[model samples]
Target: MNISGIDLAIIAAYFIAVAVIGVVVARRTRSGDDLFLAGRRLTWGAIGLSLFASNISSSTLVGLTGDAYRVGLAPSAYEWMAGLLLIVGAFTFFPFFLRSRISTIPEFLEKRFDARLRRYFSAITIFLAVVVDTAAGLYAGSLVAQVFIPDLNLSVFIVTLAIVGGLYTAAGGLAAVVYTDVLQAIILIAGTSAIAILTFGQFDFSWSAATQALPDGHLSIVRPADDPVLPWPGLLIGVPILGFYYWIMNQYIVQRVLGARNITEARRGAILAGLLKLTPLFIMMLPGAFAVSLLPGLDSPDKVFPTLIQEFLPVGLTGIVLAGLLSAILSSVDSALNSASTLLVLDFIEPLRGEKLTPRQGRRYGTLATLGFMLVAAVWAPLIQHFPGLFSYIQAMFAYIVSPVVGIFLVGFFWARGNAQGAFLALVSGHGVAALIFALVQSDIIELHFLYVSGLLFALSAVLCVLCSQRFGDAPTDAQTRDLTFSQRDLTPEETPAAWYADPRFQAAAVVALTLLTVIVFR
Candidate 1:
């Protein structure tokens, strides 16, 4: 791959601009709340774009395309199901999160259950963030950078990316992250859309031409019960459970929503993100689907995306797409660093000290934690190269961690009878089941899709939550149950929207309708 001077200049300019934005935002970040929650002043547009950017990491740009190349469109179910799930979050969990005014999702757990559950969940989240999210992002980004500069060592690039993302994220916190995400999201969408359009043009702008050479069922989002990629049952059962954990509960994605000004802002931001989620199926996944015809016989499915850029894109245009790819990578890395640090300082250190941290102390401790996680993830990032594929490695780990927590959160939210004792038992016992299932499947004693495993784990956890609460725990007092549990009144807006379209319900309905229309078109 030849690198043009124009392309190098463009990439350099992008880095400088991002650094400047982070520095500007850091000036205002003087406290823990400022660093972790953006002073709770974020609006709908920033929240929405940041959510979209943070989730669509470099691994996603590479993995989504690569998996689509091998497995067809079934891999896209994870991307689009998220839109519907975000709508569910907007109406259900978003209100609880906003009204409660908690900084971290673990803090919400502590309020609903106890400090034990909060710290437990926080420890697991920090581990996943560093080991999975940050490391994977660094690996994917470095992998792509290697494509452009073939001589660059993977380990060096991984460390370089980690340091760059870590420095600003440690400096300014969530404000820097979301603000830069606004820029990154725009670049990512534009660059991917360019590739998608140009790839389709290779088929003479005809859908039939694009599909004519592909395998049967390559365009379908739904698959048979025995399908290897994603079985239909897994689509219904496993996808939602994983999506709920990622969109609604994961501190990495939900922290921006927690930063919103109020419930209305948070709900509207989530709806906006839901709408953005639908675009990836068209702009990101379909490009790879089209590439099945445009550029066939690539040795690695992960090479599908970069190969498209090199083959079809002109030199200057290739630079723009490359920058977007970096944006996607850095966005995820920065969010993971910031969120993990937030968990370390607020959930663990603050609790240990038995007092609240001042803004200056918060910034000092938070910065130290951010840098520590960044180094740890950087060290682990290059090791991911040994995995069979980037996408599966990331998804497989999440399947083990998420189901039990999702089960406990849903049970505790809706059922006040679900006490701390049941919550603890459900988490521990559910993970116990997960470990056993993983071993059985690994030993060839049993066979189950990871998605099906998720569904199974969720059911086991939920039932245990109910049974344990009944047998071992007494009913919670009013103080324990009060606003922590769900109420139908939370769904009703306290004041009317200025216009009907301004209503969160209307926006949520519109996003849902769009998601269904997408399925109908692809199904």
Candidate 2:
């Protein structure tokens, strides 16, 4: 791929703009709450855009496009399923989360169950956020950077990207992450939309030309139960569970929602994110599908995204797309850095000390922690080359790990009888089941999709949560369940009545309808 001066200018401008935003926001970041939760002043639009941007990381772009090239559109289930699940979260989970005023997702566990669950889940979250999510994003960004600039070293690229993104995150906390994410989201959507249009234009923008040229099932979102990419049953079972954990429970993603000004803003932001989630199927995934004919015989599926940019995009547009890729890398890395540091300071440090830090102290520690995690992730990012593909490397672990966490959270929410002992036992026994299943599958003694494994693990955990709550402990007091449990208030409007069009239920319904329509069209 040849580089042009205009592309360099655009990419340079993006970097400078992000740095300025970080420094400016850092000046306003005065307290712990301001650092971790944006002083609880985020609006719906910022929350929505940040959620989408942080999630659609460089790894996501490369992995989704690559997987679509390798195994039809079945890989898109993870993308679109997020839309539907976000709607579910808007109505079911956001209310409790916002009402509780929890800084981290793990804090909610402590509120609902016990401190042990909080600390344990926080540890797990910190590991996944930094070691897996942040590191992989940096590695993926390096891969994309190398595509355009072949001489770029992996470690050098990783460190440069990390320092650029991390400096702002450490300085401004969640505000910087969200503000930068808003800019990144625009670049990402516009850049990918351009690539999609250019790819489709290759076949005179004919959908049939693109699909018919490929093998059967290439354009289909639904696949047979025996399909290797994503079986239909996994779509129904495993996808939702995974989506629930990522969109609703993950600290990095949920941190933006936690920053929203109010429940209405948070719910509205969730609906906006759901609508945005639908775009990847067309803009990102479909272009990869189109690449099956547009640029065939690639050495690897991972090359699909870069190859498309190299072959199809012109000078100025290439820079914008590359900037978008950079945007993705930074957004995911920064979100993870901020959220992981938040968990360490708020969830672990403060509690262990038996006293809350002053707001100034909190902000200072949070900044140091963000930079510390940033260094750790930068070191680990390049090490991913020793592992399998990025998508599988991340998703396989999540499949086994998230099911137990999701199980405990859902059980604790809906079932008032759920006790701390049951939640603990469920997590312990559930992971034991996961380990056994993982070994059996690895040894070829069993053949089950990871998604199916997720479903099975969830069932066992839920059952254990119920039984142990009954067998070992009494029901929690009404005081313990207050505002934390499921209730009519969760379903009700937070503010006074708004116009019909402004209602969250109405907006959610529209998003849901659009999501279902998308599935039907591609089914």
Candidate 3:
């Protein structure tokens, strides 16, 4: 893995540009809202790009490709299934959040249930975002840095990533993150696409040979009815629950949508993100499959992409690819930093103290919180090295935390009889069930993917909340009507400008291009 001077130069230039952009944006940020939520004025284009960039982290670029290298395209189920869920989110979930005009998702919980639920969710979200989510990003970034600069110590890599991501997030917040994300997304697409192209060329662009050489299960879009990864049955129930929670309710991801200028823009942004996600099969997953043919029996699956860069790409191109990897890492890290701080400052500190801090005061606290999380994440980054698969680890962590929260939100929004007490109890009990299952499985007391356990717990929580709410009290007359009014608003028109969705030219062109690419590759 001898990186050339040209590669280092290109990578250095990209980081300089990103840092400059962050500083420039910081100068324009007027308050905490502007910093954290982009002044709630982001257009559909910015939101859409930001969402795509934030979601496609180094974990996806490096880890997904590695998974594909080891297990084939099966892991792409996460990306492809997301498209269908995005449609559901655009129509079902977007309306309620937009109409309510709330800053944080936890705020909605408080309104729908009690402050206790809000506090619980807020604390959980912040801890996960800072400790788990941010740690993943930092760990991945450090791995990339280690490959690029092997002589550099791991602590240096951690500090470098933490400082760069922290400075930008603390200074400019979401506005800076979104702006840089757009640029980072472009770099990611171009860099990954270039690697894929070069890798395919090495195999003479032969899918026939590639598919034939791979294992029997590698090419199958549908996994076995009992497969652990896809598990045919799980797709019907498991994926939808996971996707809805991630794109719709998860604070780190949904925070991008919450920053949209209007409901229409948010919906459009979400739909576009779904569409963009469909590309992972080619860019991330396919590369890994191709890596199987090119770099067989590699000791670590996570090293696939870097190995490809070292083998196929020219000197300058290597720098560009590394820059893209850095972009992916920083985009996710900064987004987590900004969102975690927003949750801590808005949901927990202000409410607990009964103190109405001004936006400036909020910004000060937010900056401190962001730095605190960065320190915590830097510590946890090293632990991920012990995990078997990055993709599974990420998904499993979210399965326990996100499923119960989604269950509560759905019941609160749709079921009139879902009282605050029921919502609170269900959340606690659901989490308890998930924890018990996780402990049991780790200790060999039971055996199943945490996804299955989470799905069951989610169902139990939703059903119990509904039943308990009904048994305890009469449904308030205002509850059902208010819920319907909030849920049924025409989100498309309300959020988007008329031309946004009505303009069929872009969609048609994108469809045609994708069709052509699919035929060219798979044919």
Candidate 4:
């Protein structure tokens, strides 16, 4: 575990380079549009890389490996399923978002439904994103940091992460986040791929040897319906629902797509992200799946990534991998900070103001909001220790909060007969359903799997939306529905094939093919 002088220097160089990027970006940022949407100049390449980098958080790296170590490859379902969901977003949501020219995800709801619903959506997104997603990243990154430098205090690490990432996010806004995220994505891919290669070498590159003496279900993606870890039914129902919510509806993740210059760029970015999503199955999760035969009897599964880093990889490479892991933490945290601030400024504050603030004024407020939320998340991050584990903490939290939101979006978008009352009811009642399930599961009053519970709540929410729409109101005028709902434009031949590679149909086909291949190979 000892880091050599060269390794430390390489790590230091990464930090300094990141700082320089931040300063350079900060100088160029002035308007709210520049800060929030990267001046709407982001290309597909940056958007795709940023999307992947932001999503592959420190928590994702540590938690995916740890979950693989503890249970099996079940956790990789979240990663793989994400690719399919992103494709869904590319076809269904991407057109509406770019055409609407909106900044925040909730803004679409406002056009489709009403302001109250939009406000409600924004509140839920901001709260969960900052409290759950951002806090978890800080806590996870701090844990990984402590592994490399035992002398580093958790509080110090959390605060340092918040401040360093926050300064860039506050100053350069989405531009800095996306730009820095590209570097982060490369580092993470390179470093983690190298680790996977080295780990495979331990078994003479034989899958059989690496999986030797593995526990039952350790290499499985499918499991019994009643399986506590990840039931097979969860894969069919809950995983797709949650993945849709994350890839299509979530603000922090979609902010990259939102910043893309056009639908073509956004579509391309989404496809690239979907392709990258397949990597963790090989590079991150499977190593821990196979590590059972090598590094056994660990007290906690969450230690899998750190333990692997300690066991293999030469000194300089270890530092690089560690830096990549930390980059995930930074990218995710900064995305959350930027997004929470965007929701606050765009959804909450901007509407309330009588006279809109000047662009400079808006940028200033965004910086302050980012700093404030950064502090809140940094201080709150360590509270995750009270949970069972990092991955479990995130899964349970998302199950309860995000599923209902997804349900509302589903009905609100697809059903033209859907009314605002129904959408609002779905949002409120849906969460009520999810919360009850969460409580029952915790009290052991219900034996239902968390994933199944999530699926049930989402369905319940969708049904509520339907029934309430029938009762409370009539359908919107066709004029009111223009460009918001799926139109003939979505299915046109030009877009249908869209060069085969970029087409949503082909992208979805590839995702399904890869997913089936994975189940066949690993299950």
Please give the lDDT score at residue 352 for candidate 4. 90
Residue-wise C-alpha lDDT for candidate 2, range 501-520, written one tens digit per residue: 99888999999999899999
Model 3 per-residue lDDT tens digits across residues 1-523: 6777788899889989998999999898877788778888887788878888988888778888888888777667677767666666777777678778888888888887778888888888887787667888878777866776788787778778888998898998898999999999888888888888988888778867666777766755566777777676676667778888778777888888888887767877877777788788887788888788789889998889888888888878888888898888889899888989999989978887798878888789888988998888888888788886566677778788778888888888777667877877788888898888888887887888765766797798898788777776556568433753344454334523366445423443454455345434432
Angstrom error of the Cα, residue 111, model 2: value is 1.6
What lDDT, from 0 to 1, does candidate 3 have?
A: 0.79
lDDT (0 to 1) per candidate = 0.91, 0.91, 0.79, 0.86
> Judged by TM-score relative to the true structure, which candidate is superior, 3 or 4?
4
Error of 1 at 376 (Å): 0.3
- In candidate 1, stretches whose alpha carbon ends up further than 4 angstroms from where it belongs are none
Give the C-alpha miss distance for residue 200 in model 4, angstroms: 0.5
Residue pair clashes in candidate 2 = none
Please estimate how well model 4 matches the true structure, expressed as its whole-model Cα lDDT. Answer: 0.86
TM-score of 2: 0.98
- Tens-place lDDT per residue, model 4, 38-129, is 99989978988999999999888988888888888987899988887887777778867887899999999999999988899899889878
